[model samples]
Target: MSFQPLIHMFSITVESNTPLTPLDNVNDIAIEFLTHIGYLSKGYTPRSDAEDTSNSIPYVLFMDCFMKHPHKAWTADELAYELKTTKATVYRHINKLKSLDLLEEASAEQSDGKIKKGYKIRFGDLRKAWSFVEANVQMAMQNYRKTVEHFCDLMANDNTD
Candidate 1:
């Protein structure tokens, strides 16, 4: 089953440089922000010709568990058990969050009294974690501006020659 077809737009309108959500609750705010930034979406049902692209579990875990406990380090096994999903599934979502510079790896002692690799929002602060993402985005935009300016200069020189 492919989930590509089932994924649909979930919109949060912007007016005068501010976001406006149709629903004004914390969960909806989380969903709208995540959706706007390409994290969550209105997931699609898989088709016979498509790969099973169901994405709710990880997102739910993030919103309910990780976001709720941003100050705590969560192990993969713990998350998998909590969500009733596999360790692989937990890690897949973890890696995606890590890629966004929102999560950081740390070690934590589990209930079973063993130390395990874990993750928490970077610096135990989502706002701080997002600063890293914003910095990267700003740098990328600056690089693109430089590239465009260089290209224009090259074109001007070419015209002269």
Candidate 2:
């Protein structure tokens, strides 16, 4: 079996931007912010077949289920029910958040005495969760730097024309 780290591979766009005054509406910020962080698909356009595709499932999953109740540990079943989607769909979005290292697995005991696994924002806070993403990005950059340096060393030592 192959070993998989708790943190999965994720891509985030890094760009310098001037700080802007906060928007009054959360959705305005959420859509753009989520897209920027690689949570929502960039340049997303509504499908012709769907009338209200602008409110995408992933967006709802993030805003309604997670952000609205950051402190609550949500099970896949609960998310599916809340979003009126299937467990498979819920898991897909959950995995996306997990890949970003923004969600943490939490275990909760049901009234039936069974422990159920759930997902919540890391430490029930987005700010704390973002620190993990920053650390991962830093480590990845360091690794890339090492590779570039090694390649330069290899070229310097190569005597064969």
Candidate 3:
């Protein structure tokens, strides 16, 4: 994996003067990066005739919840309660993050001592989880390169035959 993510992170800011740290600017930074990676849209407004909630709200809220409570494993129910959203909404966002390989399943101890299945940022570290994703992407690219090279070699040999 390259250091581009680190570089990308360093390059992000909440605004011209707001320092990006202490969870204050992290959500905006996360949103920016998510947009840059195609996981989110920059901004949108539904037509006046339509009644669609901005999908970006759930994504931003879910990410901000994590940034605020970084180590807290969360069930969809908990997220729904905290975000004042629905379980289905929470799960939709959770699934999206999961698809990015950013979240990991875990067991959280409930108030009554029952262990509930939940999720958290992988290893409780966003940067570390991002590195894991970058590694997977790098490996996949290498495999694709090998396949293309082999395909080209086969085509060259077939032409001679």
Candidates by lDDT, descending order: 2, 1, 3
Per-model TM values vs. the true structure: 0.72, 0.82, 0.68
Best by TM-score: 2
Q: Which candidate ranks first by lDDT, i.e. highest?
A: 2
Candidate order, TM-score descending: 2, 1, 3
> Candidate 2: TM-score?
0.82
Q: Give the winner by TM-score: 2 or 3.
A: 2
lDDT of 1: 0.70
Model 3, residue 86: C-alpha shift (Å): 2.6
Stretches of candidate 3 exceeding 4 Å from the true structure? 1-27, 42-56, 159-161
For candidate 3, lDDT tens digit of each residue in 44-97? 442223243233445545566765666888877788887676788778667767
lDDT against the true structure, each candidate: 0.70, 0.80, 0.66
In terms of lDDT, the poorest run of 10 residues in model 3 is 6-15
Task: Indicate the TM-score of model 1.
Answer: 0.72
lDDT of candidate 2 over 1-161, digit per residue (tens): 99785554665666565443467777877877777777777776643233443377788888877888998888888888887788998898898899888999998566788889999999999999999999988988998899899999999999999
Q: How many pairs of residues collide in each model?
A: 6, 0, 0
How do the residues 76-120 of candidate 1 rate in per-residue lDDT, one tens digit apiece?
Answer: 988988877788878877876876678888888988798988998
